[model samples]
Target: MLPIKLENIKLNQQYKNREDYFKKMGEQLFSAGLVNEGYSTSIINREEIYPTGLATGEINIAIPHTDYQFSRTTDIFITVLKTPIAFFRMDEPEKTVEVSIIVQILFDNPEKQPDILKELMEIITNQRVLKEMIAAQEPKEVLQHFQINN
Candidate 1:
């Protein structure tokens, strides 16, 4: 199991926009030795080309990631925003989604990405789990929910 550091879990964070959020997140990941310095730029660029936002109907979420080469290890950073921000839908770039939760996935092993992503999408799309995650007030609560479901 990939470890999610409690320090990386942020709740009620405020950001000007999606780019600002990504940049800040990239900096934090780099400082934590989770990703390369260039990971941030790559993430922003990748989001522009391949948006990761998904509308679960219960709550909107975004899973942003970059190439495996940009990562140092496998880890996930979870951010729950106080105010939802606009992000382009993954399947339809023209469509916009208000994302309240951002899951920044960092993987050094390219092979595991597919399986991990599949599992992640399953959890994100599940209305019950999504609701629980959205309602979580603390990082521990969210982590516990994921651990129970994982």
Candidate 2:
């Protein structure tokens, strides 16, 4: 099972940009003992170099992450925004995608990132699941949806 706590799932959050969102979420992860102190900075730097945005047909999503060295454990933090934010697409950095969901990955083992990311992409691209997740009223609902589906 994924190390996704209900507390890690934020609903209807407001952030000015990717950096602000990452910093806030990173602080939560740090408090929960999921990430190291500098994890947020590393994530910001990494995102600048390699954007993790994806424009799926259902909804745009961003998977912000950094090296495993910055993580204390393996966990996934989800933040559903009140309004979509612009993020550079991973495949086409020149293009920007309006991201409604942010999936922050913190893993202690680098070897598992590829498989985890693949599964996350599959979940994000599923229209039905994505719609359900977006419409979920509470953090527990979001976690339940993921637990049942993934």
Candidate 3:
């Protein structure tokens, strides 16, 4: 099963920068025992070297993740920002994309995660799904989309 839970879904949060976003999200995940103590720093460092933002559709998205060493479980934390935040584009690191949705991935298995990653990519690129997720009022509204994928 895909590691998406109600507690992991956050909607309409605001953060000025990626660091602040990861810091707050990492705290929640760490408190849930899903990631290591250094998960935030690890993800932020990874982002600097390799950006996760993508222009999948009109509503751009970012998938920030770290090495399995920082992950305690195979889980995904999702957040829809209250306002769009500029994140460096993955394909073109020099460019920035305004992302409305952030999907933070945490997986303990490198070999097994690719399949789930592929599935998530499919979900990410779907314009209808993206719109539905963004328009969601509650956490369950966002959670349903992943549940359907699972």
Candidate 4:
């Protein structure tokens, strides 16, 4: 793991659409000098191809990511939307989603693979965890509630 913490991750208010969200996230990471120039575009492109939207039936989530080379350090950004954002489902490509949260992950190593997604999936899949996360108004509260053991 890198020296970066969840504190480094931010919930951007600038995102209106998926494109805007990613652009803003990339801009934040790039301007912070945490990633390269093409980082954001790469991740967003990969998201379009693979599609990370998850539908829990209660609260949907979008986990967008790329090939793990976009970051100078391994990190993740968690953004809670006051209003749900539309995304495409991973399993059903033709389906659309209304996601309440967006988690933008940057993996520095590809070997991490399913672990990261697995953890995220576990969190999002659990109604209890989802409720806690959604109820959290501040980023610090969010960081406090979610813990990554790996």
Candidate 5:
């Protein structure tokens, strides 16, 4: 499993729209040398093509990300939104979304992506885990929750 470090995740700045938020967070990751220059565009385009917004009914979430080539390492950038952000639905193209958290994962190897996704899916599907993450105010707490849940 990948390292669950609080340093890898952060509280992103507020944005008027999803595009702005992605750009902002992407630049932060890029500046940290985590992702390539074109990573943001690649992720956004990927979302446009296949979509990553997953709806669990009770709490909607979006897993906006791209392949490993665009990143320098395998890590996850988690951002908790003070308010909801809009994203198009993955399964339902006609519908839009109000995502509370954005999990931007960077997989250094394609082989590890499946396992990471599976663990994340398990975490998201559990109401308790989701609630804990949403209520978490500190990065350490968030990392601890991830470790416990995963």
Candidate 6:
């Protein structure tokens, strides 16, 4: 299975903007000893240069992340927002997309990035899975959607 647990998944989170999302999520990961200090700021900086937002027709999403040096372990953290937030599109940085879900990826080894991302794309592109994630109230319900790879 993926290196994920109940603590790694947050449901119906409320945040004002992208910065708030990264900072708060970074804090949680830091508290868990999964990332170093300033990881949030690193993510913010990276997002400005390389936005992760993807438009999937029904539900748009963002996969925000930073360099491997900031991470202590490899894991995926997911947050389903109570309200959608606007993030710059990855394909067209000038344009923006309304994203309700945030998938924060952490990996200590740069080599693992592609394999991990490849696994994630399957779930992210599935509208049914995205719908289930937004509706999930419990952590187990959320995890069910991510275990397909393992």
Point out the worst 10-residue segment of candidate 3 by lDDT.
Answer: 141-150
Q: What are the lDDT figures for the candidates, one per model?
A: 0.84, 0.85, 0.89, 0.74, 0.78, 0.89
Per-residue CA lDDT of model 5 for 1-150, tens digit only, reads: 545677765653467877887788789888998898899898888878877777776667788778789988888777777787788888986688888777778877888888888888877767676677778878776687678655
Which regions of candidate 4 fall more than 4 Å away from where they truly are? 1-4, 8-14, 148-150
Compose the digit string of candidate 4's lDDT tens values, residues 1-150: 322266754553445778888888789889998788798789778878888888987888888877766777667777777778788899997888988878777777787757777776766687676677778766776676555543
Model 1, residue 16: distance off in Å is 1.1
> What is the C-alpha lDDT profile of model 6 across 21-87, one tens digit per residue?
8887888888989899889889999999999999987898999889999999998888899999999
TM-score for each candidate, following the candidate numbering: 0.92, 0.92, 0.94, 0.86, 0.90, 0.95
For candidate 3, report its TM-score: 0.94
Q: How displaced is residue 97 in candidate 2, in Å?
A: 0.6
The 10 consecutive residues of candidate 1 with the worst lDDT sum are 141-150
Off by over 4 Å in 5: none
Candidate 1 lDDT, tens digit per residue, 32-122? Answer: 7888879989999999999999987858999998999999998888898888999999989989999989988988989988877876776
lDDT of 3 at 142: 86
Off by over 4 Å in 6: none
List the pairs of residues colliding in candidate 6: none
Error of 6 at 118 (Å): 0.4
Q: Candidate 3, overall lDDT?
A: 0.89
Pairs that clash in candidate 2: none
Order of candidate numbers by TM-score, starting with the best: 6, 3, 1, 2, 5, 4
Error (Å) of candidate 3 at residue 60 is 0.6
Candidate 2 stretches with Cα past 4 Å from truth are: none
